[model samples]
Target: MDSEKELSGKTVLLMAIATGIIVANLNYIQPIEGLIADSFQVSKAAVGVVAMLTQLGYAFGLLFIVPLGDIFNRYHLIQIMLSLSILSLLLAFWAPSLIIFGVASLLVGITSVAPQIIIPYAAYLAPSLHRGKVLGNVLSGLLTGILLSRSVSGLLGSVLSWQYVYLIAAIACTILLGVLHLYLPRDPRQKQHMQYGKVMASLPKLLAKEKHLQGSAINGFCLFGVSNVLWSTLAFYLAHQYHFGSGVAGLLGLLGITGVLFASIIGQMVDKYSPRMTVGLGILFSTLSFVIFTSLGHLFIGLIVGIVLLDLGTQFGQVSNQAIVQSLSLQASSRNNSIFMFSYFLGGSLGTFFGTLAWSNFGWSGVCLVGTIFLVLALLGHLFLKEPEKLQKVS
Candidate 1:
C-alpha cells in the first residue's frame, strides 16, 4: 500500500508523536544550564561542553547515521536509536557531574535522529506538487518543538528541578520508542540499497558532479549561519545586558517561530512562482531584521519586532533552499537531503560557535555584525546570476 494510504488513525498519530518527541530532544539542554552547572559545582563554561558534545554527536551522526536511512530498515534503526536515547537521557538525569553528563548528552544527541528520518519520509510519501508545502508543515512542527523545548525545560526545571527535566524527556523517549516499534512501517528499500562503503565514498563524487547541488548546499550554509548567530547568542544579550531571565528569553523564541510560519507561507509561494524570488526576499528580510535588532538594542519593543522579521527571513530562505536542492536530484533524493541538511546544521553549528566568539569579543554589537555580514553574503550569493541555473562556486 502507498504510505499515504497508511496514514490512518493510529499511524498518523504515531508518526506525529514520534516526530515531535525525537525532534524535541535536540534542545532539552538549554533551559537547565544553570541548574546543571550547580549540580556539578562547575562554572557555566563546563556545561558549554555538553552543548558542543551534543552538536558534535549530531554532526557525526548526520555524517554516518542519516545516510543509513537510504540503505537500511529505518524502522528498526529508529527503534534502536530511540531506546539508546532513552538510556542516555536517564544517564543525563542522574549524572553527578558535568563530565558524565556530557557523555550522556553525546549519546542522546547521536541517537536523536528523528528529524532526519521524518524529512526523508516526507520525501518518500509526498508527491512533487505538494512536497514543498508538506515539508514546510513538517518543518514547522520540528521548529516549534525546538523553540518550545526551552520553555518546557524551564517549566520542568522550575517546578520539579532540572534533573526531572531529563527524566521526563526519558519518559517521552520511551513512549516514542513504543509507538515506533508498534506502528511505523518498515521499508522494502532497505534490502535494495548498495554496499554501505559505496554510499560513504560517494560524497566527493556527488559533490564533484552536481553544480546545482553545491549551490543549494552553499545557500543553506550561508543562510543558516546568520540564523544560528541570532538564536544562540540573543539569550545572552537579553539575560546579561537586559537582565532578562529564562522565562522571557524563551518567550522571545516565538519571534523566530512566527518568522517560521511566515516562511512556511513563502515556501508555498516558491511552488507557485520563481524560487529566486523566494531566495531574494528571504535574504532581504534577514539582513534588515538584524539591522533593526542592532540599531534598536535597548528598545524592548523594537527588539521584538526585529526578531519577528528576522525569523520570517530565515524560515523562508531555508525552506525554499531545500526545495531547490531536492528538485534537482531524481535518484539522489535522500542523498540530496543529507547534503542540504548537513550543510544547514553544519552552518548552524559553526554560526553558533562564531556568534559565541563574537559575543565574547565585541559583545552584542559584534554578534549582530557577524550576522549581518552573513546575510549580506547570502544575498550577494544570489546576486550574480541564475536561481534556475547552477552557481559558479564549484569547479
Candidate 2:
C-alpha cells in the first residue's frame, strides 16, 4: 500500500463498516442490563456497576493501547484487538456469575479500541482537503452501530436471553475480523522501533502544550458525560415510567438515528465553517435536549424529540472536536487521539456512575439534573475559552 495514496471512497466505506462493527461491542450491554440483572438476581442499580466498569476499561485502553497505532502496524493491531474482543464477548456469554461477567465486560471495553485506531488511521490516509468529510462519513457508521446495538440487544434479550446478545456479538466480531483481514489496508509508514515508554510519556506533554487539545478534551469530557447520563439509565427510566421492556427502550434508540443521518453534513460544516461554531451549536442542542427531558419527560413524544436533539448535539460536538484533535499533529495523531478520547470516556464513566446514582436517589428528575449540570459546564467552557490561534488557522 502506498503511504501517500489518497483514500478511495470504497476503502473509506469499508473502514466505516469495520468501525461500526467493532465499536458496537462497547454498547451491547446498555439496554440489556435489566435482563442481565434478572439472570444474576441483582438489582437494576447494581448492574450499573458493570456499565461503569466497561466505560472505565475503555478509558484505560485509550490511554494505554491506542497509542500503539503510532508505533505498530495499525492493520495488524486492529485484527488482534478484534480477535480479543471476540474472546471477551464469548466470556461474557458463558459467565455464570455477575463478577465474571463484569470482568468480561471490562475486557470487552479494553479490546474495543480498534475504532479509535481506525479513526486516526483514516485521518492519516485522507487528504487534508477532505479529512473532515471523510471522518464524518466514518462517524456516521460508528454512531449508527451504537444506536442499533441497543435496539438489537433489547430485542434479542427480550426474545431470548441477555447472554445470547454477547454470543451473537462474538459471532459478528468473528465475521468482521475476517472481513478486515481481506479488505483493510496496511499502513506502510508505521514506526517499528518507537519506544512505548516515550510514546506514553509524550501524552502529558501534548496535553500541556496544545491549547486546542485541552479545550477540546474538556468539551469532549462534559459532552460525552451528558450523553451517558441518559443512556446508562434509559432502560430503567422506560421501565419505571411507561411499563416498557428492554425491547421498547432499545427501539427508542432508533430515534437518535436522525442525528446520525446528519453526521456527514456536520462534518462538511466543520470543513466550511469552523469547529468552534459547530461545537457551540452542539452544546446548545444538548442543553435543549435536557430541558425537554426535564420538563416534558412524562410524555413519550417528549422522549422521542429529546433523543433526536441529544444525539444531534453529540454528533456535532464529537465530530468537530475530533476534527480539531486530529489536525493537531499528523505524526502524533494516534497519541493525540488517545489523549482526547481518554478524557472523553473517563467523563462517560463518571457520567454513568453519577447518572445512576442520581437515578437511584431522585428518579428521572435526578437523571435530568445530572445531565443538565454537565451540559452547563460544557457550555461555560465553550463560552469562555477561545480556540488556539493555530487551530483557527488550521480550520
> Could you give candidate 1's per-residue lDDT for residues 235-255 as a string of tens digits?
567767777655566677655
| RMSD per model, one decimal | 3.8, 1.7
- Model 1 CA deviation exceeding 4 Å by range: 1-17, 34-46, 188-190, 384-386, 389-395
In model 1, residue pairs whose N, Cα or C atoms come closer than 3 Å (at least 3 residues apart or on different chains), thus clashing, are 259-312
TM-score of each: 0.88, 0.97
Evaluate candidate 1 by giving its C-alpha RMSD to the native, one decimal. 3.8
Q: In model 2, which residue pairs have backbone atoms overlapping below 3 Å? A: none
Error of 2 at 210 (Å): 0.4
Residue-level lDDT tens digits of model 2 in 130-241? 7888889988888988899989998998899789999999999898899899988877683678899999999999999988898889999999999999999999999999
Model 2 per-residue lDDT at 155: 91
Cα displacement (angstroms), candidate 1, residue 379, comes to: 2.6
Q: What's the distance in Å from true for residue 385, model 1?
A: 7.7
Model 1 gets an lDDT of 0.69
